[model samples]
Target: MSEVNAEIARFDLLVDAAWPAPGRAEDGGWVYRHAGGVTKRANSVLPLGERADLPEAVDRAERFYAGIGQPCVFSVGMGASPGLDDELGRRGYRLVDPTLVMTSPISGDEAAVGAAVEDRPSERWLRTWWSVDGGRHRDTGEGPARTWGERILGGVPAGYVLLEEGAVGRGVPQGRWLGIYCMAVEPHARRRGLGAAVLRTLLAWGWQCGADSAYLVVTEANGGARALYEREGFAVAGRYHYRVRS
Candidate 1:
């Protein structure tokens, strides 16, 4: 693989570790993940590396998700098995959520204001995040979905930040790389600097904990968020999208 592709593969692994699904199984080089269908990233397949029998692997992935009552989905990252995305497309999978992976070096001097960072997400932190982002995916009413979301958040050791009850974010440090996730600011809090504060706080926490670089994933359509991340020194390092069977 080329150097850029290799780096993208590395980031893919870091992202998987950062936001792990509670239920997972492997079929050849493909990983089938499910978390009660809470999020696509958790429920979809990660078709990384190479498969000796690509068609059989795809068939197995479809069956896995079908058994779990989820639409068969594949996260087609830069490191995904060659032609997997095209094969899925030919099989009538609809492409969704073209996303970008951004990265930046951590300076360790990032300042944290009133935001509070915790080892685990608090009830308030979860509620704040759900309030801002949950509605986008599903209903805000809490139950199994919320439970699954929390489980995913706690799958790995990470720093959770809450800023003035209006913003929240999570940072997982994997060696020298920090994976940032769940960045959300309340609708009413958009104009304020709460989002940046939450990000800086997470970066500072990650750097102090030994991470030298940070990365995050954001949907390409989310220009506002992309702008925020860009202003914070994050640049697009890779791209990926999901293919959902129709």
Candidate 2:
């Protein structure tokens, strides 16, 4: 298949696995809660890959979200798929924050890492992680907002690698068939390979948990981290992103 076709195929597979309208949130470009209690988001504010109609799309999406009492979220990565990242931008959707979509291919010969994934995270790690990522959402206590992270956690499918490292951080797992998100390695231990170590450990765990493959989203690119995943045999499968407004 051509690169474009391959990219589209990959997106289709992900959409089917995680964004099935029949299963949950499927309002067609708006937010739809999944039967699994997971929320599915697509860029309804704009055409897939077309930044031109984004303004109108966001307007329509925002109105839809308000009417439905749900928030609009988009899934973006390095893959070639349809998304509303741009329309959301012109409509005042701020392109902010970072979420990773990573994948780990399964194999018989590939070695499964056995490093211990910390079930108990250190207080310092948790504090620092929350400081960097948690923000006001912890204290907001607003409708839907109160359960921000909680919803994501609660919605995790049955076979996902969802190990929580005590108070430190929650492991968001994503591989070929699964995608990990919001990975935090903590500030004090920044230089060390703890973050990558945790990822490898989780990938290993994901394989053991019966996930055939995995994938996650990464922003632009970090030389060191990108190199590491590449060394571990990961490549950019596709890209998806949308504009966000605060």
Candidate 3:
């Protein structure tokens, strides 16, 4: 594979290291992941190879997520088979969450705000994360959401970063790369450079941890986020879209 193709192929492994999946299975060349059905990404299928057995793999993935009471989702990336995405579309799977995976070299820059990095998320950090991403109240029972934020995130060697009056982020440094996840800044905190500060803080942390590069995923339509990351020297490394059964 070419260099770009190799990165696309290895993308899922990198993400799995960052956002852990507590419940996982493999069929044919597909990786089926579920974290108590909390998030769609965790419960999605990653087709790593193009093979004659792909149909069987799809069947197994569908059944696996169905057993857990979640819709079957497939994350289609650049290196996937040429017709695989079209096949899913023909199968009544609507496209959702077109996302871009962006990457950049670690920079030695100062953060606008002091970011508190922790091995475990404090109650405040968790609350902040859920507030922006979760529609329900933070006090909602420790169901799949908690399992995802606490168990899955805690499973890896992670840095949960909370910025004062600004932003929240997570970083997982493994090997030569650091994966940034769950970055959010409050609406009122926008345009004050808090987002860039949160990102720079993570990159600084990654550099301190001996990471040479950093990567993050963002929704394709999030223009503000894309622009912010671009200003921080990140470029689109690859793209993926989810296919959910209709």
Q: Pick the candidate with the highest TM-score.
A: 1
- Candidate 1 root-mean-square deviation in Å: 1.9
- Could you tell me which 10 consecutive residues in candidate 3 have the lowest summed lDDT? 135-144
Please give each candidate's TM-score: 0.95, 0.58, 0.90
Over 4 Å off in model 2, which ranges? Answer: 1-25, 28-59, 66-104, 108-132, 136-138, 141-146, 158-176, 221-224
What ordering of candidates by lDDT runs from best to worst?
A: 1, 3, 2
**Tens digits of per-residue lDDT for model 3 on 103-197?**
99976663535666788888888877877776532322336566465777787888878876857889898888999998888777778987788
Q: What is the C-alpha RMSD of each candidate to the true structure, in Å?
A: 1.9, 6.4, 2.4
Model 3: number of clashes?
A: 0
Which portions of model 1 show Cα errors greater than 4 Å? 137-143
Model 3 clashing residue pairs (backbone): none
Ranking the candidates on TM-score from highest down gives 1, 3, 2
Please provide, for model 1 over 1-246, each residue's C-alpha lDDT reduced to its tens digit, 9 standing for 90 to 100: 898789888876788888899988987677888887788888789888877788888988887777766788899898899978888888999999999999999998888774667899888889999997777465333346788888899899999898865889999989999999999989888889888999999998888899999999999999999999999999999999999878
Superposed by TM-score, candidate 2 places the C-alpha of residue 34 at a distance from the truth, in angstroms, of 12
Candidates in order have lDDT scores of: 0.87, 0.46, 0.79
